[model samples]
Target: MATVGAGRDAGQNLCGCCDDVVGGLPTGSDLDLLREGLYGCFGGAFARELVVLSPGSIVLAGNHTDHQGGHAVACAVGSYARGIFRANGEGRIRVGGRGLPAIQLDSADLDARDGGLDDLSAMVRGMVALFLQRGLAPGDALGFDAYLALDEPVGSGLLGESALELAFAQGLNNLWAGGTLSGEELALAALRVARERLGGSSAPMWQLPVALGGIQHLSFADSGGAVAERIDFDFAQEGYNVCLVEVGDGRVTEPASCSSILQEMQAVAGALGAERLGDVREVDFMMDLPVIRDQFGDRAALRAIHFWREDRMVEHRVRALKAKDMHAFLELTRASGASTAMYLQGTPRVARSQAIMLGLAVADENLRHEGAACIHGGSPERAILAFVPDSVYELFSQGMNAIYGEGACRAYEVVDEGASAWWL
Candidate 1:
């Protein structure tokens, strides 16, 4: 048998655009590291026979609005949660990766994960169990050993968890089911795992972009997060780069703190007899604010107002992108950011970081010229999403890292693919 990690061709050419999407082709050494890591985890069997999956997204517009079935513009970034898998034939599943301990569980015991649930293990088990419940298997008749590695940080609200869920979900499907699931199905399935098992805050907003891939204008209906209109969008032709600046102070923001944004929005929607804020017209919402105020108070009224305006901003931004008008899009993004800060008031945890990001957007010529930056969304996030003219991208990166520290900024190229898997 070939030694572990001996053959590198297994994952090569799996993603045709990996080089272009991953900031130019990875060097031989980079590929070597990937292979070496695979070998180190599972030896020759897993290294020689494996599958790879990538997660993709950067919300260009619409923040904390998708759960309300609102419009959102999402771009697919190159970063991935690569899951390498091979059938174990032992009816047990094993998972391992960087910063994650090797986890092994009998196929019969996956449901037992809840008793002493380690968050990550429960997540993996939950994902697998979800698939099985849907009458799908993660591999052939045999179970599998999987290894996951992410190029992005967890809990930055950059869709890292969503990416992991999609990558694993799709990878398992491809391995066991011959990739029969459609893109829409895979995306929805992953969202279900996040919502049902992980108790995630946002699913459709994050899952759709990551699962569907590419630059998309996702118009979610006022209904409860099921219906969506997907349209193609392009920003590269206009020489713009999407940069996600991780301003995290080395801590993951808790979901409990950010949960109130959606909860309050939902409460307002319920009071308005609407499923989501989007169902209430701007004029109607304003006219009804007094009635809403009496019950939910001004805080809820203001948050609901932000939702209405945020949806409008997303609609306008989508039009701007479609018209190839980058200027108007940036303006709308700035307005949306301001509204988030002032009206929504859901970013208390990252308020200081938000201030620092807004300051950079206004003061730094490199960032300010033909670019706009914001706190990413109304939900508490440690990162800011900035759209910079390609000409100033490098300078913008330098400026951000100088302030936020090196490795804080990442420039993502929107790609045309999503949650795909391949077998070797």
Candidate 2:
């Protein structure tokens, strides 16, 4: 296995360096595919290819609180999306990846987003919009040609869109802006891109880990500001491992079940005179619980309660991790999952995804006290995060994989160093 990065400033050819920097990647990351895919349109690799890498993130704790301007703890995982960029001097930005057809558009014309934030084309447009807003895009932009690749495991449910955008923007920053922006600054630009696309209301906290790859305890303020503190601790030293469990696929996003939870949470927030639960004091919310329930019904009140508690739990979870208090951290994550499921899970979007409940059940029943599990996020999450003692990792991963699907259970570490975390 090798690191298949696009050649940098040394006039590295995309096809020439395949054997050296491409094989170590995961699915959709084969450098040959990138070479063939690019060669199909262009003749060869451009001189001085600039390679960029960005990691996909997971919500380590604190679910459903981002939109409320609450706290969250996230980690950038080993899964990654990569970009090989070169200045084409063609006044056009062309972006394509393996299995993603090449789409060409004028760089100057990237003034509007063409699709959703998750859409590749639209994400590129969003990135450009942020770049332009920051006066980062050059006046006489030569544009760029980028061939992107990804290393995330299939069925892991990671959207590499943000990574691709970060890689694109980071490459442009280096080529045009003299690489002046810090990793966190680049991440903030990416977050702005997503917020612009999704609007200012939705929670996009996962952006922190993806753009600034590492373990971060993030506190987002009501004014739309953020504070990211690096949680420097080693799980390996504690003899534990964290894995993302993919329950099922094709689970539609924003199903009624998921929307209902948000709607209910918002309804309660409105009743309390705050736009988000995080803005309201916990004691104030608790005192008004009876009234909130009478107005929005019991479920709405329950959801609001979960929100305030989970928001506080997020901070505690970060403390537990920093202090190496695994047992405390493990329990908090589990309780958050329980609260999310009981008060906010709403219902399953599809018949198959009902397996979500079953998956949690299975984990709880089999893993016992030594391990802990939690649903990853709302929108009727199809994945769960499990922390298990490393001594039993082999049996645990194998057993879980047999129940879900082979390779559906992969272990990951807190990737703080090397190219995997280079985005930040």
lDDT of each: 0.68, 0.68
Residue 234 of model 1: what lDDT?
Answer: 63
Write model 1 residue lDDT over 5-116, tens digit each, in one string: 1112334554443332232223244444545666687665533345565656777788777878787877567887766677767787778876566777777777634422
Candidate 2: tens digits of C-alpha lDDT, residues 108-201:
7766554554566766777776777778777676577777777753223443355565666677777666666766666667677766764434
Candidate 1, lDDT over the whole model: 0.68
- Badly placed stretches (over 4 Å) of model 1 are 1-35, 46-48, 112-118, 138-140, 222-232, 248-254, 349-366
TM-score to true structure, per model? 0.85, 0.86
User: Which segments of candidate 2 are over 4 A away from where they belong?
Assistant: 1-37, 153-156, 198-201, 249-252, 255-258, 346-353, 378-380, 417-424
Clashing pairs in 2: 3-21, 4-21, 4-22
Measured with C-alpha atoms, the lDDT of residue 209 in candidate 2 is 66
> lDDT score, residue 304, model 1?
86
